[model samples]
Target: MGKSQKQRAIRRHNPMRVPDTHLPKGLASASSSSSKNEAVLPIIQKMESPEVGERKWACVAVSNIIQNDPSTRRLLQGKNVVGALIARLTDSEEEVVVEAMGSLRNLCIDGGYDICAEMYNKNILTPLKAFVPKISTTLEQYLANPKAAPENAAKLVYEFADNVITTLWCLSETSNKALNAINALQLVPFLMSFLACRDRLPLAPVTAAAQCLYVLSDDNEPAIDEVRSNGEFITSLLAIARTVSDARTSHGKVDIRRLQLGVLASGVLKNISPLPLAVASDIDIDKELVTMLLPVLQNTSLRDATARVPVLLSEQANEVAVDKPSLKNTPKSDHRSPVEIELESIENQLRTTQLALEILTAACATLPDPDVSKHDEEADEQEDEGMEEEEIDEGVNDEMSVEGVPSKDEVKSSVDLLPSLVPVLIQLAEPTALSFPPLANPSIHPPTTSALGAVHIAALECLNNIFLSLARNPSSTVQADTVAAKGIWDGLWKSLGLVGTEFGLGQERRKQFWELAIGVLWGVSMVWKGFLAPDAQEVELLKLFCNSSEDERVRVKCIGTLECLAQCPTAVDGNKIIAEYLFTLLPTDTTPPAGVEPAIQAGSALIDIYSDETFPYDVNFRANGYLERLVAHVDAMKKLVKGIDRRKPGGRELRLRGEEVRDNLVAFLKYRKALKL
Candidate 1:
């Protein structure tokens, strides 16, 4: 491609370059990335070329490697690829600089933590120190005289800004040393420059700045102090988050990008909000802003419909996702030119939804009991009117320049918010099965599933918080009787287990979800064996325990749910119900464990049965070949242990667990082989 054409390609499809908004596992195929690496040394040699085209092409090729295959990302870490790109940051040619910065920015991203540490070790910020000011100088010049410059000049400035800001943000995300270096650069004000008068700026750089500022401000006292002092900046962020970027798409439909922009803006506010003590008095409209923004908290309609937007959001600028039947008949909006819309992604939409749920969870934690038991006309009116704007030209238009987000009391809804909130949250908490994004070629999950998984986890977290908060709040309308509300319990029981079962989600998230389940649901499970116990035809927990796919901690958590339920203090019948359930899964005279899985299952049930405080210790149990049954379980575990090849990935852990189960069985000899019970 020619230079101008290449710049447009960078503009129209900037998948890997935009810092923090990376999709989990990335969008490129592993095979595609792998195939590109055969030319690594040639590319590195080209990167040192005197010719701008060769150097730029080299950088672009390295970026392609970074984006497509994580295996290649790992492979490139030890090579001269990163060092070669860092050298191009100061290249006399602007295109070479852009390409090099883009390649290095991406390396820090999907390339993973080791790459960031590598960049830091290479002293990346040294070249970046000079590079930041160069972009700043050109950007200001363009803003001063946009029309005077040739076409694509301003776009180049914005692209430069996007790559630089995102690169800085990615470095800070992984290493504190890089963050300190960035802070020394004093880039916060420059980042804030994109926020105040965003009308003249392209949305791409503005979103990049917003995302970077949000990330850099986190937990850094110096950055937070800088952010806190700028009340107008804070208020503008809140307003942008509260309102849409633009009202319509080319088709005159509500632009999905508009919602995504608000989400990005809100994400910054989420980091800074419930403002610190020093600047607390400066911004005066806090409660009003909360009232305005609260509706997003209750609105579940903001979910990304890949059918309504492109499957790969990089292609979104060139194509409108017209897969939805509703969008089919809608006439295309001719008002805004194709040049006007900024890039937005399904990843952004998912992140936005998760942020809203998370904010609501925090808000609900502080909420007083409902003043009224049902939502009334007044609360509904505020919700309806608070955020729906008529329009704001093509930019901030003065309406976005709020002076403050100062505090006052919140709008305690006249009617309960939970009835409306819970159902949507329940839907979010479940595993999503959206059709349009399509599963990646070989992977079973869709391109957007990791993002969706985050939304689901966020919804569950919010739900868990609601459960505990309402249960204890004396004035709260959500009545947690002795157990979860009938509706809440019914909605979550199956999905909760399924959430822990999803492979796409990190095991830590699944572990956190399971632990939260026990904390909130154990009382109910102890009361109702159906929640924790395996049934006649199938067993969710037992199968999960044996399924090799599940992480050991997650499996421990799943089984931990049962172990905790058995010991929980509930009604007298709770223990009896649990004991009867355990006995059914244990080995009997005719039914020894059929295989390794069944053997593990039998051992787990035996432990619970032998340990149950209220277990009906029947002499008839041992009389019915109980000793023989114990021997069978022990023998099964022995075979399970002998079968392990300890050299394999999980084999050692499997062998250890098998031995542990066998030992636990033999430890039961007093009541088992002796038949003394």
Candidate 2:
């Protein structure tokens, strides 16, 4: 009985035993093999079949195999496959035709423009068009679902559109069908309809549409006008764009809604301009829509991104205006109520408001100058040079003489309200910061995101405009004073250490701040080239920025400013000034302020300048020891991390440090190696 049980256990557990060929275990494995064979058998079996349905399936199977299987797909080129697929499009069997079309689509998928171009050249596009209704039907099915993958659909549509658009262009370029290419133009309606559907206009379509619009808009006579008229054909395109541009979607996404608004703006502007060839007897846009749209173009947000020129066809009024003070603030009257300590809440809010007002006042010192000079130049140039002297003498020119192009005071007053608008832009930044508990309650700190970054951007822009205005000054009387430039430098310095880690910041905000800081400093560096001439206080401020334990971006800015300083014509010993302390705070081997990649790039840019290859030795000039030491330190650090493993957290920190160190070391070593001594 023990032996029998042992034998049973052995039979049940036969883990290493090989099965007999004819046994059920082997038979099951054989069945799997047989099924795979059957799955593949049909493809090859039908390849040369006389049956129409069989032939179509063969074309599809080969196409699918070529598309899905790497080995088979390689066989699709420069051969009978394209010809065979094209011929099968004429097959009577529907399945055959569909499969053939599907295979051709697959070939075109990977083939890109060359194959599409080839197909168009071969007049193979005629059959391709026949398949569009089928493709569009499929596209519509995908679009109907609320959860449709908009991106995937866009790619497919772009592919189809590319083939069609290119084909149409080629056809149009020739003597063939300059006007009537029904096959190509019909697809335009499908694309336009997709724009309305919301699921159709993904990033790819936005890109494709830009390209497609340019292609379709290119006509010789009234070309711009012809493009504007397209809006008339499909008015809903503008409507969809408007809807998308205005939408903010969930928190933190780019207001694609704003983008669509710009497209609408562009389309509208196109319609207004050189296009339509005739000024409308009456324009469709009312004054209010004009008011709403003009601000968008005027907004600093769109100006930098779109570079739209906000032409004042006529001077438009500000939408939300601060009314002129009706009466001056009078000394408290005897009738005034007693002090209201009970309303502490009101007092705190008032204090907060006053603080914001002060910041804006300080920020305004940075804004760019207005275009007064250009206006003045035009005003001076238009003097009766063209008119006959006798005719000019006979005419009463008093009515035609414009009141001296708006005074500087008038321009300043018109834009003075900009400081007031700073708060609203700050309010937009507050929710993102979460540092300040919103603007409703009184707080010591302003909203960090809005006040720090947004204000910085606005300040930079205003400074740019101010500089531009100064550049345009007709009179040598107005110049960029050190006081104004100093105020800007001080303001930027105060904000320097405040911009912390970049992880929580938006890319646009970060970019804006960096750009503003770099630009302003570059300008300031130019203005104060010889730091030698600045007052004692300005020199002290420079010293603090270089040596202080401030924020990293600020340090980065200082380094950048120092680099710019190096370029200034008036800079005396600029290299000596920067070389003294820059290496201490912004060591190339360390993780930079915010520890962001861009900060690292900025550091690398500085180190590159220190290399001897960059600054080859000229014995006549003093040797730059500071640059030499910086290179040496980077080298020692690089050698220490060379053999260390870096997959773990400790390793990662090492790698970050190691990367900076390595770049610095390599740069330094390269210079050191190049030294003759």
Candidate 3:
């Protein structure tokens, strides 16, 4: 009796130990060597008990087991472990609830389908939903009286909000059930509210809410539709995207939280509207939202930082003072941190660039495709001519008017962001050095190579979209101004120079570079034809790129650019250079041209030149002898097409293209004859 009484007294004094009388059958047999599954059941049973001390002990035990032993996760799912944890969400004891949330979160980290599905079936989110109002109340209280609020108010609010959001984020990974639950609970607006209160709230919950929204809306149309339907939610998200904190460290660096918030806001925007115009259709976003994003797309801070050149004399002196022999033994320097930060800046900039591009792409989608519109207009005219006068009048009435379409002014306002965007592209397209300290071992902290092919590709696509938008809305005076700006043209020319120089760039990037270059040329010609003439260097680069074997798309684009240049009244010398180049591709009266594709492309370009009534026809005809060379090239194309066998690969298509060129040439000759030229 004395020994047993002494042992019981000792156990009663030990706060960390659960008395054997309190242990369930599962725990009573648990030992140090026992598997966690065998140990979790009894602890889970105590977690559901009414006694506060037992519940607290059980919660702590379960958290440790689940956090430390990965295998216990599936074992805990065997019974009503998740259901019990969910029920504990509103426990009067905050510590118990926190432990439960942590364990639940851990379970979800690798909690396979069966575990999550079981939790979903048990309606785990019901108790979680009850905490939302608590978060809202805390946020409202803080907003009303920030100075008077309890010290733990912000902490409590963030914990509750983050736990819920994280649990949902985890659950959403397994199925759409979590998302469905979120929608049913109307949690989207709450999450939006948290993000809106970001100025006062901690970033952890704000980011958690953002991430939850990102996951919930991604590829989930119903969620996206819901997000879109909420005007306030959309407004709040855009505000977050635009908000920039003024906080900076002693080093003068902006807080990383600001960058993260911007990125998350971008992710949310991408998930919700993805297509900017679709969003614009329902809301007046063209001005406000686009204005917010344009600055990000044009961010040249990374470029500015890397482009900073040290004074030449100082650099030379520093190089001379460095001891080369001791470099190998020198420890790695802290200078690499700035390079790392620069890379981070580049990453953030890329994210912003991508978001801006998505917005632009969406805006572009709302407008008509220029080529498709032209084809449609031609088809309509033919159909109208075939109808009787009364029928034609009726048809005109039935035809949709372009009046409701977004005006060129609106389109221009959006695409005019291109001028700001082009310099960023040129900056990113060129490589920059990431040098370590001279004394540091080069092998240890070797210069960081800036591989921005993805950035380059995105920039190219953004440029293409801008060009496309401009082409579709030729009446946009704003875009015309953007195009005619010296900055825009200078950026384009500099980018063209960077085409083949991006280190570690892949073939796709090269193709993208050419596509962007050619697209800019064509866009300029289409909108402000003959207004800007190519300089001799520009013309020569086009010729070189046009003749390149690097990519067929590049060559084709080069030819198109040359044609555009030739049509400019200010570029008669360019026209002559182009004419001579095309002449060289002609069959020398004996053999066909080496490359059938280039020949066809050259012939097509010449046809475009001859058909350009806007060009100074007398100068082309007299000074350049363009008419004579064009006729000769057309004759050579006819011979080349005839020489190719129709049965070979691409032979038939090549011949067809050649015949089309011949027809265009013949039409131009007839026009020339009619004018007695």
Q: Pick the candidate with the highest lDDT.
A: 3
The residue-level lDDT of candidate 2 at 531 comes to: 40
Which candidate number has the best TM-score?
1
lDDT for 412 (candidate 2): 52
Candidate 2 to truth, TM: 0.30
- Candidates 1 and 2 compared: the better one by TM-score is 1
Report clash pairs, candidate 1. Answer: 250-333, 251-333, 283-406, 284-406, 285-406, 286-406, 374-415, 375-415
Q: Tell me, what's the RMSD of every candidate?
A: 17.1, 27.0, 17.6
Q: Model 1, 558: alpha-carbon shift in Å?
A: 6.2
lDDT string for model 2 (440-492, tens) is 33223222222333334544544433333232222222223445445555555
Write model 1 residue lDDT over 1-677, tens digit each, in one string: 00011111111112232222223443244335455556566677788898777777777777655554565665565466788888888789988888788788777656545577688888888987777777778777877987886777776777777887777777776566777878888887888888775778877778778777866665566777787788777767767766653435778554445565566565555556667555455653333334543455444443444344333344544656443222113222224333223223445556566656655554444333222212332332353345332331223223222222212232232115555676677777665443212223322223355556556666666655554443333323333332435555556666664654433422444544544453334323433332343332223453344344334333333343454344434322443444444444444434333433334544665565455324444332444554565665455456665565544554433444555566677776554544444
Better model by lDDT: candidate 1 vs candidate 3: 3
Residue 169, candidate 1: alpha-carbon lDDT: 72
TM-score to true structure, per model = 0.61, 0.30, 0.52
